[model samples]
Structure formats: structure tokens, C-alpha cells
Target: MIVITAPTGNIGRPLLSQLLESAPAAGEELRVIVRDPARLPDTARGRVEVITGSHADAKVLDRAFEGADAVFWLVPPDASRPPHDGYSGFTRPAVQAFAAHGVGHVVGVSALGRGTPVADRAGLVTASLAMDDLIASSGVAYRALANPSFFENLLEEADSIRDKSVFTDVVDADRRAPLVAVADIAAVAAGLLLDRSWTGTDSVPVLGPQDLSPNDLARIMTEQLGRPIRYERQPLDELHTTLVGYGLDEEFVQGVVDMKRAKDQGLDAGVVRTPDTASPTTFEQWCAQILAPAVRS
Candidate 1:
């Protein structure tokens, strides 16, 4: 049996599709913990058992994790909530349920930078790493899908990019960092969840084909869209003010700032992309296939 959390999310949605397609031959039974049953497609709701509630709730987790052999865990981000409450606090209950319910394997969505200069200071990444530690302490074989920035992030700025041919960020325009596509992350998660050969806890780095700076990304977008695209570098302080003005809590705002600082200081730049870690999708490919369509719409 397999239990997945955040089934309606970017990674979980795709992962559920892959698992459902592959489960028949393996005779695997699948289930999901989703807050809203309506958010799930009718096809998915019919195919798997749905436990409708937040996975962070003890009773919800207990009901969802029972009789499950492997689980896909993702702690959803809530900006108004405290870091501990959103990340580690939520995982604590699910971790207890994992031990109590005898779930043997866990595949979690985490970030890269476990052992780096800014790992301790990178706000969101620091909390995510702490969540990984809590899960590992539970004695279940775990794999944390440690990923860099996702190509999907561009969608958040697609409207601005479409209107002005520009995207903005606090990271250095010249800082080349690993930018992965979430589909690659989902594919990796589905593969690990389906196989039980590995033991103990480990971090799987899912970097994209190559490191690309914001300028590089701009150039690619220009070619793909047939228009000049530019990257506007917003100062960290200004960006912090902007997010705060949007009603985000101070801690959440700080984490976003800290992550940009860490990325600018080369936290993601050091990761070596190889056949194992390198995903097939590239920035150009994602622009043409994914981002461009969203912009056009």
C-alpha cells in the first residue's frame, strides 16, 4: 500500500498519475491525504482511497498511514504560519504516525543545501533540512528529494514577463544555479516510492541539465518567445519590503530573503549535475512547452 500527501500539488499531482499508471502490474494499492476531495480530479478520486484532511492532523495521519508500506510526504507552505508550525511541527505528527502505523519507506520533497556554507542560515531550506532530520530519526528508510529552484517558479512571474518582457528576482543576475523542472522531481519521487530496494535515509539531488544564470534564462526566453526578455534584479531590502507589504509574516519574508542570499552566495551553484542527478528538461524546453503556453493564455 502507498500513501501520498499533497496529492493536488505540483509534484504530487504528477506523481499520482505515474503511480496509478504503473500500479496495476505491481499490484500496489494507492491512497492519498488531501485537504479537499474536490480539488482532486474525478478520475483520481475514483482510482484511489482519499482521506480528506490536513496530513498535519494526528487523526488524519493515523487514518491515512495505516497499513501503508511507502509514503510520499510534502509539507505545504503557509506564509502566515510560523516556520516550525508549517514545516517541522506538521511533520512531527506524520512522523509519529509513520512509526505507529509501520510505514517502512518515505519519499519527502525537500531542498538542496544540506552541507553548505549557508545551509544553517538559509531560512526555508534550513527548516526543510530539519524536517528531514526528524523523519530520519523515526527509523524508516527515507529519501528526501533535494531539489534546487524549479522551472515552475517562472509561472508566478509569467504575467509580468508577458506584459513587460521581464522577470524580477533578488538573486544575482550572473549567478548560475541549478534550476530543475518539477516534473523531473516528481518522476524521481515516483521511482523511489515504487522501489523498496534501498535502505536507511539519503538525500537525492535533482538538478536540471545545467546551471543557468538569470541572464541565461532571459536569453532563452527571448529566443523562445521571439521578443527581448530581461531580468530585473531587485535589491534584497526592496524585495523584503514588497513581500511584507503583501501581508506575509516577518519570518516567512526573512526565509525568502535568506534563500536568495544563499543562492547569490553560491549555495546551489556548487552542485555537480551528472547523469544521475541531471534531469532531461532544460530551461528552453520548459519555456517552449510549459511557460510559453501559460504566458500565451
Candidate 2:
């Protein structure tokens, strides 16, 4: 049995489908941990067994991990809460449960620059690195998928795109950094679960086909939507206030600013390959295929 967490999320939903489709035989079971089973689509609900509960609940986790050969784990971000063990209050309990359950293999969703110079800048990234350490200490065969920022982040500005015709961020307009699709990340993760031949603690960084900045994103957005989309760089002071105003903790806001500075200084510039690992869909393809349609109506 293959168990997946955060099944209703961007990656988890598709990852579940891909696993069920690619499994060697028809009887291969795919299990997903969900807070509420009723929210799942009829197709997914019909295909997989739904274990109801949050990832942090020990009872839910134990039941989900039981009879499971591998698991995909991730902690949902909660900026409203105070910073606790590695960005989320749930990581410690989740990791502890994985150890207690003796899960054989795991593919964890983490961030890039996990072991790099500027890793400490982002509280979330710093915490993710720590989470990976805890998982490794469990003595399970593990792979932490170190992913760059998701292109889906742009969706956060759906309202801004509609009202102002611009994309906004604190980072420099020309500071290019890699962005990967959550789909690619999910595909790589599924591949790992199907074949747990990996050994020791390892990090699989997925840098997308190219590095892009706000300006580059704007150009692509404008072209795809046939509208004048532009880049708006928020002032650093205002950026901090904005994030905090949105209910994020002060330290989390500061950490985000620090990461932007790291991006400006080119600290996030690392190239990695996922050759034969998975087929990566490009940003343009994502825009043409996903974003454009969402924006059209």
C-alpha cells in the first residue's frame, strides 16, 4: 500500500491519480490521509481508501501508516501560528509518528537552499531542513524533494491581476530564480515511492527548465492573456507590513524579506537535473494550459 498525505492539495491530488494509474497491477491500493472524506471527488474517493484526520493526529497517522510500504509527507503552512519546531507546530509529531510506525520509505516536500549559505534567512526553509534531519534519524530510506517556489504562487495575486494588470513581489524585478510546477514535483515523488532503491539521506532538488524574474513572468503573462501585465516591486518596509498585516508572524515576515535579499545577492542560484526522473512541464506551458483559462473567465 502507498499512503499519501495532504491528498486534497495541488500535488497530492494528482500524485494519487498518477500512482493508481501507473501501479504494475490492478489491485495496488492507494491510501490518502484527509481531514474530511466527503470533500474528495467521486473518482478519487472511489479509487482510494480515505483515512480521515489531519497529518498531526497520532491515531490517524498510525492507522494510515499501518500496512503501508511508503508515504509522501508534507506540512501545510500556517503563518497565523507562532513559529514552532520548523515553521509548523506539526512537524515534530509527524516525524515522531513516522519513526514509531516504522514507515519503510518517505518522500518529503521541502524547499531549495536547505543546506546553503542563506538557508537561515527563511524560517520555513530553515525548519524544513530540520524536518529532513529528523526523518533521516528515523533510519528509514528517505528522499526530501527540495523544490523551488511554486509557479502556482502567482495565483495568490489573482485579484491583483484582475484589477491592476500587474504581478507584485518584494524581490528585484530582474533577480531570476528557478520555479517548478507542483505537478513535476509530484511525479518525481511518485517515482521514488514506486522504486525505493534509494539509500541514506538524500535531497532531490527540482529546478525547473529555466530561471525567471518578475519581469520575465510579466512578459509571459501579458503574452498569454493578451493584456498588459506588468511587474510591481513592493518596497521592503511595506512588504514586511503587508505580510504581517495578512496574519503572518513577524519573524516569518522578516525571514521572507531575508530570502528576497538572498535572491537579490544570487544566493539561490543552483542548477540541478531530474533527467529520467520525471517529465517537467515548462512555465509557458503552465500559463497556456492552466493560468490562461482561469484568467479568461
Candidate 3:
């Protein structure tokens, strides 16, 4: 049996779809811990067992982890609390449940910069790494998928791209770093969850095919979307002020600022993309396939 948390999220949704198609062939029974079962795809109904509730809840995880051989873990973002509480605190109960239920393996979604100089101070990434350590301490064979920024993040600026022909970020226009598609992350997670021959706790970096700067993204967007799109760099202080204005927790807002600063300082530049670490799907391809449609619609 394999249990998947956050099955309706960006990464979990695709991971669940892939597992639905492949797990049955491997004689694996699937289960999902979700807050709202009604949000699941029509194809998932009557196919996998559904455990309704937050996976962060001890009772929910206790039931979900029972009889489970492997688990696909992804924590949903919670900006109402500090980074540590949002990440590690939300995962503590599940860690205890993993030990009690003896779940053999786990694959978690995490960020890049594990051993880099900036890692310890990268706020949210630091908390996420600590969460990985907590899970690994449970004696489960764990693989934390260390990833960089997502191409999908640009989806948030769809309106800006469509109306103003511009997108904004805190990163420098010329700072090149790996960026990935969430679908590719899901593909990597599906492979690890299906084949559990690997043991021990380690991180798998899902660096995309190439490194891209904000300017490179703008150039690709301009070409793929058939328009003049430009990159606008937002000041770090302005980003923090904007997030705080939206009423997010002050500490959580600070976490975002710190993460952006670390990325600017090369937090995500630690990993070298190899065939093993590099995932398919280029930024230009994602623009044509995903972003273009979103902007047009």
C-alpha cells in the first residue's frame, strides 16, 4: 500500500494521476489523505481509498499510515504561522505515526541548498530541511526531492504578463539558476514511490534541463507567447511589505524575504545538473504548453 498526502496540490495532483495509472500494475493499493475528497478528479473516485482530513492531524496520519509500505509526503504552504511551525511542527505528528506504523519508505517535496553556506539562514528552506531530518529519524527510507523555483510560479503573474507584458521577481535579471516544472517533480516522485529498492535518507535534486535567469525567462516568454514580455525586479523590502500588507504572519513574511535573499545570493546554485539530477521540460516548453494557455485564457 502507498499513501499520498496533499493529493490535490500542484505536485501531488500529478503524482496521484501517474500512480493511479501505474500502481495497479505493480499490485499496489493506493490511499490518499486529503481535506476535501470532493475536489479529487473524477477518475480517482471508486479507485483509491480516501482518508478525509488534514494529513498534519495525528489521527488522520495514524489511519493513513497503517498498512502502508510507502508514502508520498508534501506539506501544503501555511503562511499563518512561522516557518518552523508551518513545516516541522505540521510534520511532527506524521513522523510519530510513521514510526508506529512502520511505513518503510517516504518521498517528500523539499527545496534546494542543503549544504550550501546560505542554507542555515534560508528561513523556510531551513525549516523544510529540518522536517526532512525529522522524517529520516523515523527509520523510514526517505528521499527528499530538493527542487528550485517552479515555472508554474509565473502563473501567478499571468494577469501582469497579459496586460502589462511584464513579470516581477526579487532575483536579479542575470542570475542564472535551475528552474523546474511541477509535473517533472511529480514524475520523479512517482518513480521513487513505485520502486522502493533504495534505502537510507538522502536528497534527490530535480534540477531542470538548463539554468535560466529572469531575463532568459522573459526572452522565452516573449518568443513562445508572441509578445514583448519583460522582467521587472522588485526590491526585497517591497516584497516583504507587500506580503505583510496582505496580512500574512510577520515571521512568515520575513521567511519569504529571507528565501528570496538566499536565492539571490546563490542558495540554489549549489547543485550541478547531471543526467541523474536534470529533469525534462525546458522553460520555453513550459511557456508554450502551460503559461501561454493561461495567459490567453
Candidate 4:
């Protein structure tokens, strides 16, 4: 049996579908941990076992992990909490649950550029690496799907794009970084979960289609939507203040701002290409296929 947590989320939605499609052919069963089963799409209904639970609920996690041979683990970011403590609180319980359940394998969602000097620059990434290590030591077959930024992040600016003709980020205009589709991340995760042959603390980085600076991304969005869209680089100090005002800890906001600064300084350079591990989706393709229709309506 394969158990997937966060099965209704951006990555988990498609991932659950892929697992359902692949499970029948492989003669496997699937279980999905959802906080609310009724909120799941009709397509996902009756396709797999829906276990209601949060990652932190041990009793619920035990029930979901029961009889599960493999699991796709993901720690959703809690921006409300201190950034350094977010992943830790989420992953520790998961690790404990996995150990108790005797689950055989796990595929985890993680961030890129972990274990580098810039690792600490992104508190979230640093904490994720620690979580990966904890899972590895649990003696379970594990794959850490370290993905770069997701293009879906742009959706946060839908209203701004509609009213102001601009999208903003802390990244520099000319600093290119790999941006992946959550769908591609889901596909790679599904592939890992289905393949029992792969094992042990493997860090799989999904580079997406190619690298693009915010300026390049802005150009693509403008061309795709046939409008004049622009990139507005948010000031780090202002960004930090906004995040803090949003109820995040000051230290957490500072760490996030530091990460943005690291990106501006080209800290994500010298990436390794793993052409076969997984195929990635492009930002323009995602914009055309996913974002454009949503924005048009």
C-alpha cells in the first residue's frame, strides 16, 4: 500500500491521481491522508482510501500509516510559525509515526540548494535538510525531492496583475533561477513512490525546464497574456516588514529576506543536470497551460 500525505494540495492533488492511475497496473493499493475528505475532488473520490489527519496528529497518522508499505511525505510550510521551527515541528512527528508504523519507504518534498553555504541562508531549506537526515536515519527507503521555486507562486499576484499590471518578488531582475511546475514535482514524487528499486537518502533535484531571471519571466508572461506585464523587485527591508506585520516572527522574516538576497547574489549557481531522473515543466508552458486561463477568467 502507498500512503500520501497532503494529498489535496497543489503537488499532492496530481500526485494522488498519478498514483491511482499507476497503482492498478502495478497491483498496488493507495491511501491518502486528507484533513477533509469532502474537499477532495470528485475524480479522487473512491479512487483511494482517504484517511483524515494532520501530520502532527500521531493517532491519526498511525491509522493512516497502518498497513502502508510506502509513503509520500510532505511538510507544508506554516508561515505563521517561526521559520526555523516550522519544518521541525511538522517532520518530527512524521518521523516518529514512520518509525512506529514500520513503513518501508518515503518520498519527501524538499527545496533545492540544500547542504550548500546558502543552505542556512534559507531557514526553511536548512530545516528541511535536517528533516531529511532524520528520515534517513529511521532506516526507511527515502528520496528527498529537492525542487527549486514553483511557478505557482505567481498566483499570489493574480489580483495585483489584474489591477496593477505588475508582479513582484524579492529576486533581482537579472538573477535567473530554476522555477518548476508543482505538477512536475508531483510526477517525480509519484515515480519515486512507485519504484521500489530506488532506496536510501537520495536527493533528487528537479530543475524544471530551464533557468530564467525575473525579467525573462516577466517577458514570457507579457507575451503569453498579450499584455504589458512587469517585474517589480520588492525591497528586502520592506518585504521583511510586511512579513512581520503578517504575524511571522521577526527572525523568520529576516531569514526569508536573507534567502532572497542570496538568490540575488547568484547563490543557486553551478546546478547539476540530471536529465533522466525526471523531466521538468517550463514556466512559460505552465503560464500558458495553467495560469493564463485562470487569469483570463
Candidate 5:
């Protein structure tokens, strides 16, 4: 049996579809834990077993992980909680469930930056790495899909991009890093979860097709959208203030700030692309396909 968590999220949603669509042909049992049963696709409800509840709840995981062979795990972000607590705390219950239920292989959504100079200081990355460690220590065959910044993140600023032709971030406009499509990330996870021939723990960095600076993305958007879209770097203090104003925890806000600073310092540049990590979606392609439709809407 294969179980998936966060089945309604950006990566998890797609991963669920991928698994369900392929499972029939491959003969794998697909089960998912979701807080909202209605959020699941109509095609999937009939095909896979659905366990409704937050995965963080040990009771929920206990039921979902029972007799499961492989599981896809991702700790969804909660801004109100500090990074340490948000990432670690959420995974703790699931870890206990993994052990008690005898789940064998686990695939987790995590970030890249395990070996960079700023690895220790990058807040979200640091927490994600810690998550990987905790899962690996569980003695399950684990593969942390260590991902870079996602191109889909730009959609969060869809209104700003549509109205002002500009978007804001803490990372420098010139900083170059591989931006992945979440589709590729899910694809990797679905592949890993289906086959259980491998064992042991490892990090699989899913870098996108190419590296592009924020300015470079702007240039592409200008051509694709027929508007002069631009990128702006907000001051770290300003970002911190805005986040805190939203009632976010101070430590979590700082972690976000530090993660951005680490990027500006070339933390993401530390990744080396190989065929395994280099996914096929480019920023330009994403802008043309994904961002374009969102802007038009």
C-alpha cells in the first residue's frame, strides 16, 4: 500500500493524481490523508482510499500509515508558528506513526542547500534538512526530494504582476538559481513511491531546466506577456516588518529573512545540475504557459 500526505497541496495534489492515474496499470494501492475529503478530484475518489484529517494528528497518521509500504510526506507551512516548531513539531507525530506502522519507504518534500556555507543559517532550508535527518534516522528507506525555489511561487504575486508589472522579494534581482516546476517535483516522488527496489537514505535535488536571475525572469515575462514586468528587491527589514504585521511568529519571520539573505549570498548557486536533478521545465516555459493564464484571468 502507498500513502500520501498533504494530498491537496501544490506538490501533493499533483503527486496524488499521478499516482492514481498510474496505479491501476502498475497495480499499486494508493491511499491519501487529507483534511478535506471534498478537495480530492472526482476521478480519484472512486479509485483510491481517502483518509480525512490533518496528517499531523497521530491518530490520523496511525490509520493512514497502517499496512502502507511507501508514504509521501510534506509539512505544510504555518506562518504563525516558528520555523523550528512548524517543521519539526509537525513531523514528530508522523515519525512515531511511521515506526509503529512499519512503513518502509518514505518520500519527503524538502529544500536544497544541504552543503552550502549558509545551510546552517538558512531558516526554512535548515528546518527542512532537520526534517530529512529525523526521517532518515527512522530506519526507513528515505528519499528527500530536495527542491530549489519554485517558479510557481511567482503566481503568489499575480495581482501585482498584472496591475503594476512588478513583483517584490528579498532576494537580489541578479541572483541566479534553478527554479523548479512543482510538476517535476511530484513526478519524481510518484516514480520513487511506486518502485521499492531501493533502500537507504539519500537526497535527490530536483533542479529545474536552467538557472535564471529574477531580472532574467522579468525579461522573459516582458516578451511573453507583452508588458514590461519588473522585479524589485524589498529591504530585509521591510519584509520582516510586513511578515510580523501579518501576526507571524518572530522566529519564523527571521527564518524567512535569513533564507532570502542566504539566496542573495549565492546559497542556491551551490547546486550542481546533473541529468538526475535537471528537470525539463524552464522559467520561460512556465511564464508562457502557467503565468500567462493567471495574468489573463
Candidate 6:
């Protein structure tokens, strides 16, 4: 049996879709822990067993993990709490459940910067790494998909791109770093969940095919969308103030600031992309297919 959490999220949705098509052929039964079963794809309805509720809930995890051989674990972002509570605290119950239920393999979504100099101070990434440690201690074979930023993050600026032909970020325009598509992350997760052939407890870096700077993204967006898109660098202080102004917890806001600062300091730059580490989706393809449609809409 295979279990998936947050099956309706960006990464989980695609992962679930891939598993729906492939798991049955692999003799795996599918189950999902979701807050609202209504949010799941209509096709998933008579196919996978549904455990309605938060996966962070001990009771929900108990039922979901029982008889499950593998689990695709993902913690939904919660800006209402501190970083530690949002990641490690949310995962504590599931760690116990994993040991109790004897679930063999677990795949989790996590950020880059595990062993880097900035890792200890990288706030949310630090908490996420701690969560990985908590899970690994459960004796399950765990593989944390260590990822950099996502191309999909640009969707948040779709309106700005459409209206002003601009996008903003905390990083410098010339700072090149790996960026990936969530679909690629989902694909990697699905592959690991299906073939749990090897794993003790380690991270699998899913760096995208190439490193891209904000300026490079702007140039690609301009060409792809047929508009004069430009990159604007936002001050880190301004980002922190803006997030806090939106009523996010102060500590969580700090976490966001720390993560952006660390990224700017090359925390995510430590990983060299190899054929084994690189994922297939390119930023150009994503901008044309995903961002273009969003900007047009």
C-alpha cells in the first residue's frame, strides 16, 4: 500500500495523478490523507482510499500509515506559526506513527542547503532539515527531495507581469541559481515512491537543468510572452515588512527573510547539477507553457 499526504497541493496533485496511472500496474494500492476530499481530482474518486483530515493529526496519520509500505509526505506551509512548529512540530506525530505502523519508505519535499554554511541559520530550511532528521530517526528508509526554488513561484506575479511587464524577488538580478518546476518535483517523488529499491536516509537533490538568474528569467519571459518583462530586486527588509503586514506570524516572517537571505548568500549554490541530480524541466519551457498562460489570463 502507498499513502500520500496533501494530495491536492501543487506537488502532491501531480504526484497523485502519476501514481493513479502507475501504482495499480505496480500492484500498489493507493490512499490519500486530505483535508477536503472534494478538492481531489474527480478521477481519484473510486480509485484511492480517502482518509479525510490533516495528516499532521495523529489519529489521521495512524489510519493512513497502517498497512502502508510507502508514503509521500509533504507539510503544507503554515505562516500562522513559528518555523519550528510549522515543520518539525507538525511532523512529530507522523514520526511516531511511521515507527508504529512499520511504513518502510518515505519521500518528503524539502529545501536545499543541508550542509552549507548558512544552513543552520536558514530558518524554514533549518526547520525542514530538522523534520527530516525526526523522520529518519523513525527507522524508515527516507529520501528527502532537496529542491531549490520553483519556476511556479513566478505565478504569484502573473498580474504584475501582465500589467507592468515586471517581476520582483529578493535575489540580485545577476545571481544565478537552480530553479525547478513543481511537476518535475512531483515526477521525482513518484519515481522514488514506486521503486523504493534503495534508501537508508539521505537527500536527493532535484536541481533543474540549468542555473538561471532573475535577469535571465526576465529575458526569457519577455521572449516567451512577447512582452518587455523586467526584473526588479526587492529589498529584503521590504519583503519582511510586506509579509508581516499581511498578518503572518512575526517568527514565520523572519523565517522567510532568513531563507531569502541565505539563498542570496549562495546556500542553494553548493549543489552541482549532475545527470543524476538534474531534473528535466527547463525554465524556458515552464515560462512558455505555464507562465505565458497565467500572464495571458
The model with the greatest lDDT is: 3
Give candidate 2's error at residue 24 in angstroms. Answer: 5.9
lDDT of 5 at 131: 87
Tens digits of lDDT, candidate 2, 228-253: 89998888788888888888777767
Q: Each candidate's lDDT (Cα)?
A: 0.90, 0.78, 0.95, 0.81, 0.90, 0.94
Q: What order do candidates take by lDDT, descending?
A: 3, 6, 1, 5, 4, 2
Per-model TM against the reference: 0.98, 0.92, 0.99, 0.95, 0.98, 0.99
lDDT of 4 by residue, 149-183 (tens): 78898898888887787999988789887778898
Candidate 3 per-residue lDDT over residues 1-297, each given as its tens digit: 999999999999999999999999999999999999999999899999999999989999999999999999998999999999999999999999999999999999999999999999998998899999998998999999999999999999999999999999999999999999999999999999999999999999999999999999999999999889999999999999999999999999998999999999999999988999999998988988899999999
Q: What is the lDDT of residue 209 in candidate 6?
A: 97
What TM-score does prediction 2 earn?
0.92
State the lDDT at 105 in candidate 2: 89
Candidate 5 lDDT by residue in tens digits, 160-198: 999999988887788888889999999999999988788
Task: Give the winner by lDDT: 3 or 5.
Answer: 3
Q: State which candidate, 1 or 5, has the greater lDDT.
A: 1
lDDT of 2 at 153: 86
Residue 267 deviation, candidate 5, in Å? Answer: 1.8
**Candidate 3, clashing residue pairs?**
none
Clashing pairs in 4: none
